[model samples]
Target chain A: MLLEINDIHVHYGKIAALKGISLEVDEGEIVTLIGANGAGKTTTLKTISGLRPLSAGRITFDGKDISRLAGHKRVLAGIGQSPEGRGIFPGMSVADNLHMGAYARKGDLSKELAEVYELFPRLAERKGQAGGTMSGGEQQMLAIGRALMAKPKVLLLDEPSMGLAPMLVQQIFSIIEKINERGTTVLLVEQNAQQALQIAHRAYVIETGRIVKSAAAVDLLDDPEVRAAYLGGDLGEPESIAADEPAATADGPAKD
Target chain B: MKTNESTRERTNGSPTVTNGRPSFAALTPRARDLAGRLPAALRAPGLPLAFPFAVLGLVADLFRDWWGRQTGYVRWAIYGLLIVGALLLPSEQVGGFMSPYSDWAQLLFFPIGGYILLAIGLNVVVGQAGLLDLGYVAFFAIGGYTMAVFGTKFGWSFWEILVLGVLLSALSGVILGAPTLRLRGDYLAIVTLGFGEIIRIAARNTDYIGGPNGISGIPHPPTLSEWTVPESEPFTTLGLAGIAPLKYGALDGRPYYYLMLAAIVVTIIFVKRLESSRVGRAWASIREDEDAAELMGVPTFKFKLAAFAIGAAIGGAAGVIYGSQATSIIPRNYEFIISATILAAVVLGGSGNLPGVMLGAFLVAWIPERIRGLQEYRILVFGGVLVLLMIFRPEGLLPSRRRKAELAEGTGGMGSLGAEVGGPTTHAAAEVGK
Candidate 1:
């Protein structure tokens, strides 16, 4: 495994956000974590990126224990995140925003800038425009492009499809596939399970801060339980799915 | 909205003609064209009185492009000319403009020059790094006390004490900032405000520094030479006519002014260099959004602390000079109001822009002195003027382009102020808040 999360737990104040969640992403694989809202999908990514402190777990990136590393150090250590809500520097120009992604790297960044611009030609055209002025689709492109600027070994994307239109959603997923094909491993967090599973090599289903199921994307796509709960199967009856829901044992063994 | 108009003006490739509008009748055709390009708030009724300052911003913006492209030698030459002009302020003809002040040069050297230095220093923390520091005067006090203690008790030279003052203040900055900088926005401001008070109260209670009596008889810098300018015909005609000798003395404020000018220039050069480097970019990122900046690979806390240290160092240097000029230091000399005034200067003049901050400082210092005839009403008038200016131009007098955009979009540190004024916030601001 290129990246490993061994029973990592996280808390926000007194409430646990992640409860002993374990997952792995092999090099060059597109790994997706799919779940409903408030299911700890974002928290898992946050813990891996070192934004939230890991209460009881080890996050190993490139076979090195990185649980104690700072968030910025994690970026330098080759874990780049696009972050939830598409955090583009609004005051900066499209080009300047891209430059911020390569902030830790020394020397020329023209090559990286060119590659990002090539991936999103729309961004190249609007390079001088402010990031805040761009439409939702373009800003999403900029955010992803910005994360790519770090040239990370593994890119962590938190809900890349979140406010995008269906057309743009399809376009963004293709870009993610293209990114993964270009040899950078990707850990994608998404609410759109159908699309996320289509692009992902392996998928994990998380609910209430715990990973309830893990399987290959192809297998989970056909899994009836996941299909009903997330893949929009039997859309009118969420109650039928609740009966099959596991008991609330989310409060894991209290070990610091 | 303003961006679209500027873009249209560039695309049109000709001066826009306002068809004999009554509101723009007072302006010349060219002036009207420029006024039309200003933001709507600036063009509001009753804002005409402030139009000249706005025009000054437009003119500066024109030069900013050329200034950004110039070689260091050319820039230095321009700065040298400006410094020479500043130096001539002590001359009778130049100083006579501010007739209200009995000793214009003395006032310029002490409060005006001092405030400018303080504002520039504060800008690094508040403006560039987006850290609201309400206790910046603590650094100033640290610098002032360093000079007083070292110069009076140890009998140290002014140069040695000045260096020590900067180091000590920077060290204090790191000590204060290391833990507190993690607090965001208003929380940080409140902590800093308390820190400022703690410093003043600590100084007041310390018997070694004379308690409430404060330190007195702080030594002046050593005189270089007693070379007096000749009262020749050519010198008199050029308004270089002055009986002041080139030396540090009680009577002559020119030497002190010169020293202050030198310090400000050196600071400007260092700050400008830092503003263009990776360090500046890091600061901008952290200021815009700390969490995102960290995720983007910027060591946000480290850079924020760097901002504090550098800003405090400058404040300390200014304090040393200010103390030396006053020839004394007291706890009362450093007040919460002093911090507020400097912050006002930075915000009023255009927070992120250097020239704007200097102008803001100059006005903040000079206006009260200029209107001394108003007596008790002087402060009231000053407060009213600031209110009026902020009402019309919330982004500041000559805000940097990025700052202008940030304000309009209601993003970044000053977003609330912008949002309250209802500047056209984009969908991005609303989306990001989610």
Candidate 2:
């Protein structure tokens, strides 16, 4: 296993956000955690990134425990996250935002920068433009490209397709597929179960702070339960999560 | 490769394409055609008019690099000229015209130079790091008290006390920030405000450092031996010719003014260096989005603390200089008004830009003195001017390019003096996600 989360537990005061969640990603595989609103999907990613402290259990990357490591040190240990909400620096130029991604590394980043621009040519065209001014699809590309700039062994993507249009969604998923093809293992947390399952090798279904189901992506895609609960049934339209959960998806129900 | 083709295909209708290249849509049709005809290198991304300016900037950058490389002698010569110009500002020929009321030299040394120093330090916290510090004068107070106590009670040299004051202020900064930095935006400001008041109250209540009366008769910086310069014709001429008196005395504030100038120079050098290094980049990231910066591998908390400590150290340094010059200090001397005044300087001058803050400090210090006879109406006029400045030029007198863009977009809500507003973070995703 290249990355392993062993029975990690996270709590937001009295509420348990991630209760004994365990998963693993082998080298060069796209492993996804798929769930509905308020289903601990974002929480698992946050724990791994060290943004939220885990109450119990450990995260090991390449046979080394990184549970105690700081978030930035976790990046140094080759865990890069393109966070939810496309966290591009608003005041910074597109080029500067990409540069910030590789801040921890020393020396020249010309090659890395060129590769990112190549992966997302839209970013190259908008190099002088501030990150905040870009369109949604472009901002998503910038976020993903920025994560790649870190040159991580594993990339953690949180809702890369969340706010994009259907056409842009396809483009982002295809890019993610290409990224994994280039030998970076991916741990994806996504609400779009249908698309996430299509690209992932394996998938884990999370609900209310626990891993409810885990299986090969192809098998889970065919699973009737997942199809009904998360995939929005045979209609094939992505469910209106707001109608389903009523604000529970906004940072989960962790805040009092 | 196929993925790239599909992405290009989907986004094709968006970016205006001219001659199979992305063309600037915002440009006029004629300008757009002209831009297309220009060399590819000159045609910048979205900004067509920036092509010539970009070329000019590149040439200037190249020239600067060459100048820096060809000779340290030329660099020193330029700096020497600037230093001489600055040194001459307090002289009769310069100071007389600059201000007609009180001594311009004395004003420069204290309120002008001092406000600049404080503003620069606060800019590190409020501007770069996006941490609003309302009670920055607490650090200033700590510095002043450190100097006064050491100078009076322990009889320490000004040099020794200066170092101690800076260190203690830095320590206090860490003490305040370690617990409070977890609080963001206005919450942090409130905590810092409380900390500032706490320091003042503590000082006022304590008798050892001279409570309300404060400390007086603080010793001046020691002079070198009388024979360091001969008491002869040429030496006397040099002394009369505005060579700063080595012997710091009671009446002539010139020597003290020179000392403050030296301190400001040192502060500027250090600040300029830190503003471009890794530390500065980290601060920018934190200011933009704390959570994102942390996730991107910046130790956000540590960097914020560092900003506070460094800012406090500079504030402390300014305080020590102020203490020595005044020869006495009291709790009243270090008040919330001082903090607010320095903040006004930073905001008026342009927060993130170093030269902007200095200019702001100068204006803030000099404006009242310029209208010296109308002292009673100073507050009203000052308020009116600041209000006017805000309405006419919200990004400040010399905003950094980043700040200008942010204000232009009106995304950060920083253009207004809304007390609780945080720096701009991308709300597009949130809005769409919702």
* The candidate that achieves the highest TM-score relative to the unseen native structure: 1
lDDT of 1 by residue, B369-407 (tens): 888888899999999889866754666777887776565
Task: Give lDDT: candidate 1, residue B6.
Answer: 43
Instruction: For residue B110, give model 1's deviation from the true position in Å.
Output: 2.1
Off by over 4 Å in 1: A237-256, B1-57, B65-76, B237-240, B243-246, B413-434
Q: What is the DockQ (computed on Cα atoms) for candidate 1?
A: 0.36
Chain A structural similarity (TM-score) per candidate?
0.93, 0.92
Q: Please provide the root mean square deviation of candidate 1 (C-alpha atoms, Å).
A: 5.6
Chain B only, TM-score of each candidate: 0.85, 0.77
Clashing pairs in 2: A72-B297
Report the Cα lDDT for residue A101, model 2. 94
Worst 10 residues of 1 chain B by lDDT: B423-432
Output the TM-score of candidate 1. Answer: 0.88
DockQ, per model, reads 0.36, 0.36
